[model samples]
Target: MISSKEIKRKPDQDASKHYDSVIDKVLQKLDTVCKEVIDRTNQNNQQENEEARFGQQVKQKPMNEERKEKEENALLLQLAEKDKGRLHLFIKLVDYMTVETLVSINQTSMSMLLEEMKKERKNGLFNTAVNFDVQIFTPDEKEISEHLKCLLDDMIVVMRNTARVISHQSMIGYIKNTKLGELLSEQKENKDCIADVQGIITDSIEYQNIKNEIFEKVTSDFQAAEVYVNTNYMRCKPIYEFLNTWNQGDFENKEHTLDIIKSHVMELKKWLADINFYIKDIAKGILNVDGKKIKNKLQPQVVTKLENFKDYLYKLMQKKANQTLTTLQTYTSNLSKNPQNLKEYAEFIEAIQEAEQNIKGLETAKIEVEAMHSLLKSKFDLNPLKNSDIVMMDDIQAEYLRLTLKIKEAEELCKERKQEMMKKHEAEFIKFITNIQNTTSSVNKGKLILEETQPADALQQLNEIKTRSLDRFKELDKNYQHYAKLMGLSVTTNKDLQELEATYNDRRMLWTHSDKFNKLYEDLQKNIFTTLNVEEIEKEMKSYEIGILKLRQNINNLSKEGRDKVLDQHANRVGNVSQFMPVIQALGNKDLRPRHWKKIFEDLGSAWQPGKTFTLQELIADGVMNKKDKIEEISAKASGEASIEAQIEDIKSKWSQLSFIVNHYREAKDKFIIGSLDDIIAALDDHQLKVQTKLGTRFVAEIRPSC
Candidate 1:
């Protein structure tokens, strides 16, 4: 181990010592130069201060004094020119020393020392150049001062360039040490390692500051180096942002995520391509590599990874787009099958809207993917996905159009159907109105008939009208309700139908009371002779009277003018019954024999016989008297010779009829020829006529001749 290795190690140690000694000497000379510059600047400042203190007391100087001042400034410029070369050499040495020192130091220490050097240089030399006092110095002095400042600025630029080179080399060394290039080369497998490298490059404050310094020092001297550092830094910054901002879950099969991935990939490709172009010249100068080689190392691999990731995203997008298309197709197909009703139509419309939204999303997705494709082709020269891979909005729009056409056709059909239904309903309504009007007319006609007809006949006619009207009204009301509901109209109330129903109800009530009274009167007539229950008959008559009163009240309650007509008819019927009620009571007596009844009926001029049906009209038509009046006349005759006189008159009337028949037979016998058939028929005809003439003399003479 001590043989050849020790000999080689000794030379490297000596070289290191020599380099360190050289850097120290350069730094010492730079310090001396800086001190001389600081003293000269202080002297100039003092001279300026003294001139300003006396400038108000002596505003204008003489031409000779000004020439003298100029000569003095020229001499000072000549002296500064003599020291300018040394100052330039010292600044060069200082710049070289600064680069070597930065190169020799660790990255952390170099970064800290560089920051301090930048601050000191800016505060001292840069400020001195920027704030140069032209008023205090002569023209030659100002020219000399400008030349010195330019030399110092050049030295500072070289120092800054050296610092940038060292920083770039350090960054490149760090990249190499971390195997960042290898990680980038195998980004798919070493994704986490690349991510970590990106994190270091982006998140490290020291690295960021160095990168900023390189960018700030963008001059012709190190423009390539700045671009190189910036390119590497930019390359990692986006990757860092992307990697840190997103995760595997963010790449879901959704439009928003797909769009985000597409945008990021496109931006990365564009940024990476721009960075490659920016550093093309410097690639060989500073980094000692070809621009294309660097690009091929970084861009192609990164592009490949992006292409793969984009491919994954595209596949997801395709899958999602296909699903959306399938959903849209299904909705369109279902919508094409026409909806039957409002509810189904509404559901179809909602589905169509959702389909439209999905179509919009698909279109957006397609645009995003196509944009990514365009970026990749123009910038990265990648063609992983074809245009056919994208979902077409035309197909979706066509489906939507078909859906709309179907909807339009369905709407037209519904409109036609509605119009047809409305026509049919209108016809039906007209028929209903006509039927109601006819029913009302029939009721009016019945009302007219009620005026002239008997109570019983009026009741019958009213009942018929009520039945017909009720049937018609029920049908009309049912139809009205059904049609109204179908048309979405309120069917709860109809003034015409309600009024008609009320009229029918009122007439029914009037007839009902009339029917009750008629029934009571019939009972009185049926029970009058069937039983000797006079008190029951009187009770029935009282009930009949009460029924007539109620009927009259009901008639008065009627809104129609027929009330008085019905009332008058009912009153006439009741008056006819009352006029013959006493006769009915007298005929109901069970103590009377059939002969007495026959005699009484004969005297009353009635055709009614015993065991036959009796009625009040029959007795009224026969001019019958009251039972009380007949009894009073009989009692007064019984107390006098009225009964004997009535029997003598009866004997006289029979003796007279016997004498006349004997006289007529004797006359017929005297005129007759025995056994002659013609004479016998003639004689019979003569006797019949003579007897009829004698019987007709007791009856009232007819005012009108018989037909």
Candidate 2:
């Protein structure tokens, strides 16, 4: 029932199984080897324990019978001769064996443990190596000294128990050799013997038993110390294994995970520093080396973690930069199609601003990244996810402004179109005009609206209306001229009238006089008779003649009044007429009459009255002249005796005020001639000539100054 595929896979599956079985067998063989090693170590420990017990029993024998009896007798003889011999040989041995030797053993073992721990960290031995602290190995001098002191104190207890056994054996020997020894042996038969020998020897036996109990306690303490020191290896082994397999390359999201890695590295660093401190301060003398070698092994791992973290950050930044660049490029592509409307233009402007902001953010990120790694600058350009500098931010800003202006323009156009839609069309506007009773005012209002709303078409429509009105006016003019001819009156020609009307019509489209044109149009529409008939012409002519006669009469009345004033001033004033020439010039030829000048000269003969002898003040009071004019008249007649006297008195009173003014003018005239002011001349030289034809030449002089 098996398929061909399964049949073919069966042999491969069997081969895989065989391979697994072979691997399992190898692992089992390794396990068996490890077990054998452990068994051998246990056997060695049992042999050591048996040797220790045999050594203890040998040490329990009498001191004199021991191998060093001769040397011990020599040491007793030497101590007896000394005046002070507080140092016991037994104490010296205890100090060296328990304190010094044991401290060396512990320090060496701790140093080896710390070395292994460092190797584990370097290889990334533990899953949580950053969080885990290796076991406390060697401590500072004070702590190690304390451990040594405690161990030495326990050894001292064992040494004291041995000394008790030696003392008890020595005392029993001293008693057995004398009556006390005999007495103690005889007292042993009695349960409660009062003899000193028996009581003392029995008490010594009991004290010997107490020494054995003390030795047991010392052994237990020594085992406890061994266990405490051995913990260093047990705790450090796992960390080493973990570090051996740890790999920085396996991490993901380097930027986020780097924090954790860095934190772990820092914790590992602290652990190393702790070990270094212990080695330097306490274990240096014991191990014969400082822990400086371990730092080299650990530092590389810290660097690797940090490098991986930086790579992660770089990749992250590059990705974000690429995204921003893509967004900007997309916006740029969209903008190439110029926006067709205000809304589209506004959207374009928004896109440009957003792109510019993204560019600014990218620039900031680039600066931050550069601050972290200066060497990475060139590498960043080569990174796959890295984006080149967005050089289009300025272009984007320009585009923003351009789009803004475009939107404004489109809005204005739309607003104009809306206004045009709301208002009437040109044809409709003409109809509205025809329906209005006050066509002038209505046309004026419509013209203003059209000019602002739809200027070109509106003006053209208004001009057409004006042309039609002009045609009607011309027809009416012809009729008027015909009526004038019938009445035998000189008529204004139709051609001349048409030319004048044409001038006004030319300005019909202008805002000025627009209302007047409209009114003219309305007047033509209302008049049923297009022409002025003979009777109407006669009446119009009579009205014209009456207006002319009234105008002439008014002019004659004004002339009579003006002539009287001239006569009165000329006859009454015994003064020069030169001053009155300015008054004649001021009247102008258009306002003055010839008869007024004739009367002025005629009255100046026999009618030249001296008038009442009046002072200059009196002349001003009479309103005949101002004080300046009166003073000028006196100056003109200064050759006369009376004028001289009047001038003398006037000069005496006003000399101070007028002296500076007179001198300033006199000096100015003198300097004016010295500068050759009147010699400077400019002329416009223009000549017209024709070959074998008449020609004219003209010149105009002008004064110019150059400085």
Candidate 3:
């Protein structure tokens, strides 16, 4: 009873199972083979034990053999001489290695030398391999000889010792033959005596073995500490996913919305899956291989509804038929009876007949209304009936049924006519619906591919549309939310619409004001900059007023802290002005010398010292400059120095030291602020004017002693 989806194997399980079975079978075979190998290993182990024991017996005689070798040193010397004499080729090659010959010269000589070296290296390797092949020797390093040569020589010593041991053992065994029975009896006695000490010795040996085994075990544990791993595969993914899912956020005051959202998400997934082929077609269309996307998307659709305008028209017609039948019955019966109410009955019959004839027009109106309704509904949902069973006619059929109360005598005719109309309506509706459904379903599922339509551009358009729709939808949703809280279907929407219109008008007015304010702000900036001889600056210095205004504005706009910085900038600019002022001042005083200038400069430099002062008239006398000539003379003189700009700086520096107190007093006298050069001049005017009334001397006097 499991669905196919549920019955399907989980991912990788089949491959995993197959791999496991194959590995298990291979490992089982390997285990059997390993068992056979262990058996062979045990058999080999027994053979190795026997050989080792036999070797141990031979090892027991090595102590005795060493003593014999010490006693036979003289004979060994003789054998060594014979062995050395056999080394004729080795000695001859060593003799050839003189200093210059060993160091190869040209390519030819190097080749010959390499050949000789190879021969020596080969001999060394060969001697070591052959002589040391059967000897028990430790590889001890010797600095004087090469490694192979030393190994071979050491092995020769070991081999000679082995041979001597064998010879000594053979000699000892032969000598024992001379006193065989007594020696054998003594040997048996010694063996019995050694057997008596074996138990105590074995106890000591067993204790040492236990201690060694413990040491080995501890070291084995140390080595085993290098690597480790753990295993846990069950329930990890499921638990992690559950934890992650539950840890997410929840909706506020609308928990059921989550279920609805989940449903939407599932539907979205279905839509995406179903759209895969459509997306592929889109991609192909983008490649411009085909171009029929929009046409396919916009094809007109058909809708069927028994509960529509056409049905209402059919019912109206049926009602008209009933009325007609009733009117005929009344007219015929009245004509036969010759009654007084015949005129009234005949007039009623005429009215009913007229109404019945108008049914055709009513049906036509229903058809028109139904056509428009069908267009909107069918385009939205082609098979809406497939998903709905609840029904109610909103058109002609409903109207026709409603009118049945006016004519009880013709109910059967009305009912019969109603059935006929419905059958016809249904058949026609179905035919139209089926044709549209087939067309829509068979429309090749065209992609909305654009030939040259930029996807990004189209996407942007789509995004704009989506954004607009979402904005409206969000507004609608927000309204609904507020509505749900306030009314919950209590208030009609028109009231809210009125409120919205008022708010929109207010916002519109505010936006208009904002735009006007922006325009005025820009005009304000331009107007401010244009004031204060902006044109005069251009005429005089070719420096547009823009730069000057900008500079001044920037200074004014600076933070208070930044503005309160040192007047060094003013001093510097004064110096620059001073450079041009002096030459002009000296124009009328051609007899002026550098010495006079020095004296005036000194007086100005010292005027503002703690207790010092120099009168304005005195300074004028020192410079030999009068009021009429002051501006021109100062400017021309100041502009004359080698570094006019630096000289101007010197001039301003001197002016500041001498005039700072005077300038301060003048500012208090006239309420002048010290922002510009003109302010200083204005302060000076006020000071002079004030002092002139207070018994100040008008005549010039030398400001400096030397002057």
Q: Highest TM-score: which candidate?
A: 1
Query: How many pairs of residues collide in model 3?
Result: 31
* Model 2 lDDT per residue over 1-707, tens place: 23334443343344335434543454355345434544555555565576567875754667666548546644644544331132123222333343333334334433453344334222211111111235333232333334333432333332222222112232343234444446556755782332232223223444345444434433443344334334432343343444677666665624443346445545555544444433231121122122233344444654555455457655654564455445545655554545444334445545545555555564554445343333234323333322343343343345445544544554454344433332322343344334332333333344433323333455566566556654555564554444334323466444444443443333232322233334433432343321313243334334433433443343223342423222222223212322432332222222222333233323322122223222222222334333334333332332232333344345445534432212334547554223322222211111111211111111101101110
- lDDT, each prediction: 0.51, 0.38, 0.34
Ranking by lDDT: 1, 2, 3
The per-candidate count of clashes, in order, stands at: 0, 9, 31
lDDT of 1 by residue, 363-410 (tens): 565455456556555545655555555335445445555655655564
Query: Model 3's lDDT to the true fold?
Result: 0.34
For candidate 1, list the clashing residue pairs, or say none: none
Poorest 10 consecutive residues by lDDT, candidate 2: 698-707
List TM-score per model, in order. 0.25, 0.23, 0.14
lDDT of 3 by residue, 1-707 (tens): 22223323223345335534643454345345434444554555565576568865655557678568545654555554444333332222322332112122222332342343334221121111001122211121121123223322232222222211111222232233334334544755665312122222223444345434433432332222111100111112222232235322242233332234334334433333332322211111001111123213211110111223234333433444444444444433332332123233333334444545655655554454344345324433323432211122342355443343333333333333444444443454345344433432221111212223333443444344335543454365444434233211233343333433333333223223223333433432344321323233223222222323333344323324433121223224334423433432343243333544444455444332232333333444555343334444443443432233343345456557644323444637766444446656775676556434422322112311221
User: Which residue ranges in model 2 land beyond 4 Å of their true spot?
Assistant: 1-177, 182-301, 353-707
Mark the 10 consecutive residues where model 1 has the least summed lDDT.
122-131
The TM-score obtained by model 3 is 0.14
Clash number for model 2?
9
